[model samples]
Target: MPAFEALQTVPRSGELVDKAFSRAARAGRAKEGIEAQESMLITAANILSDNLENVVTNWPDFDTVDPFYRELADAVCRDTEGVPGVDALRQNLSEVGWASRQIDELRSEYQGRIRRSGPDTARKVRKQAFARFADICDEVEDDLLALGEAREALKTLPDIRADEPAIVVAGYPNVGKSSFVNHVTNARNETASYPFTTTQIRVGHLTRERIRYQLVDTPGLLDQPADERNAIEQQAVSALTHLADAVLFVLDASGDCGYPIGAQLELRDELRERFAGAAAADEDAVPIVTVCNKSDRSRGIEADAYMSVTEDENVSGVLDLVVEAVGHEPELPFDG
Candidate 1:
């Protein structure tokens, strides 16, 4: 995943103002006469403009990211009105930059006066410019704060590839979803031991011959009504709906997943319906395979709807089914 470290690292508006002022003051101290005062005001305005603009420019256009990431972003970051997050940020950034340029204009307006006046009067005008700079930064403090929050939320997104054959491992919490992920992919010990224990998405990979499949673990998304899930969980839904090429709906026949067989089945039915509906609605439905797990246990449960895999840690057949469903051809049939 592309990291939002640049957004997270944007300095507070006050910090930028202070840095600009201090740097300008140093430059002024280096020069002599009215030129020093002129240098101070001009440099400060430029710094304020550059720093604030940089903050705006560093943010990626969230609306235009890959489907998985864009949907995930919509889930994590609150969208305003019908406007997308990136558009809103772009608007705020424009305002911030315009205000910065106003500061430059302020410096320009004072240039003639500073050039004509003595050092004392020039110093007073410079102070006035600084004050206006402070006020301008103060005005955009809320915008800065909003950007920071969005960036913070964006940091939690996983690194699942949107273009690959994504195998979204979904089921009720703790149904050996993560364990199965570890079995098939590079993720070992990447999952938790309890229900709702894995909050964010966990990602791994499986490569057979030359083909690679992306494996994703969505924790809080699979076992609930779609309307009832919060925004955070909805992010998982977006990924599953828009990004997944196929889904691995894990079933806990041993009843160790905390939900009863009936409850699990109910959730499964809902998910099946939802997946079918989404695919039909968009004509991009992803195929799902049910894998009955925990065969090592003696719960005496049965899931006869699809293939079954026991605790022996072999899922090559399931992987082959996934590949075939997603329309990918292995160099050879999966023999793992």
Candidate 2:
């Protein structure tokens, strides 16, 4: 098997296998547990090898293995039927996966270290491997935690901007916030055709006839709690509060914003509350311009008394309406 060949070539495979078995024994699965782990490892290796061989033999395009090893590890952890010391087995399997990944990383490092240090490399490689393994484990944990935090932040974010003459151009990421920005302004900003392409806020100035206004292309806000937003995303949202003359809330009519229209509207209401002051302070609040973008897509939530458009539709019509909504443009550019 290709996986077996790769495993055998690893200088520390024996040590890794021994350590895995030892951990399993300590976890009170000395008898069947060790054998089960070894069998699983061998099976995974063979499957991986077969998949690799197919890819190599095919030369160009190849199908990837279904149920990748990480998924297999998760499955193993969840299984408890007929397996003695099931918890121990799960832990052992996870450890084996870790060891396998570590071995692969070490092998790559060894090549680089050997080239730099010549023949006297064994001791340094061992020390470096230990440090690298610990670092990788810590990094994995930190990333998982950060992802959790980001999800929570996304949830807490308010959705609607009721009072602000704000125009939010929200849609599934990469659905043309930046493109719309370019169309409205002479400013050139990066516009890419990929998800999460705009990681930062890009604001531009747009002038049509005698009216001058600011348009902001905000970072993609997924339907999640506020605590779940990453630092960059939070900053992007914050930037909106600071620079927004009026919000052009953009929505990609074609893509899912991960929630129903009601939920999005609720979020918008929450945003209005958060950014706009109490009912008594309504006069100081900003007005929102709800835009349903990507008109090319037949699907769109009917915006309430606000402007909406498709991919082929120009925003100039909406802009004129917005100018009227906010009353005549200020004689001078908005000082705020």
Residues 1-336 of candidate 1 have per-residue lDDT tens digits of 454534546678889988999899899999987889899988998999888877777877665667666665555555556455556666677777787678778877888778888977888887887898899999998788767777776665555555567777788887777777777777452432111224656778878667788887777667666776866575557656777778878787777778787777777778777677778878877787777777666345554333334445446776777677778654557778
TM-score, candidate 2, is 0.39
Mind giving the per-residue lDDT tens digits that candidate 2 earns over 1-336? 211112211113333334533443343333243333333333333333232233223221112322122122122222234232223333433443554465455545544553455335534543454445445434334323322232233222222222223344443355456667677677664331112223544445555565555554555543334566654444345434533344555554555444455555655665555445432254656566666666656345675333223344656776665566556343567679
TM-score of each: 0.83, 0.39
- The 10 consecutive residues of candidate 2 with the worst lDDT sum are 2-11
Off by over 4 Å in 1: 1-8, 79-88, 116-120, 187-198, 254-256, 295-310, 329-336
The whole-model C-alpha lDDT of candidate 1 against the native structure comes to: 0.72
Q: lDDT (CA) for every model shown?
A: 0.72, 0.42
Local error of candidate 2 at residue 239 (angstroms): 5.0
Angstrom error of the Cα, residue 42, model 1: value is 1.2
Could you give the C-alpha RMSD of every candidate to the true structure, in order shown?
Answer: 4.9, 18.3
Backbone clash total for model 1 is 0
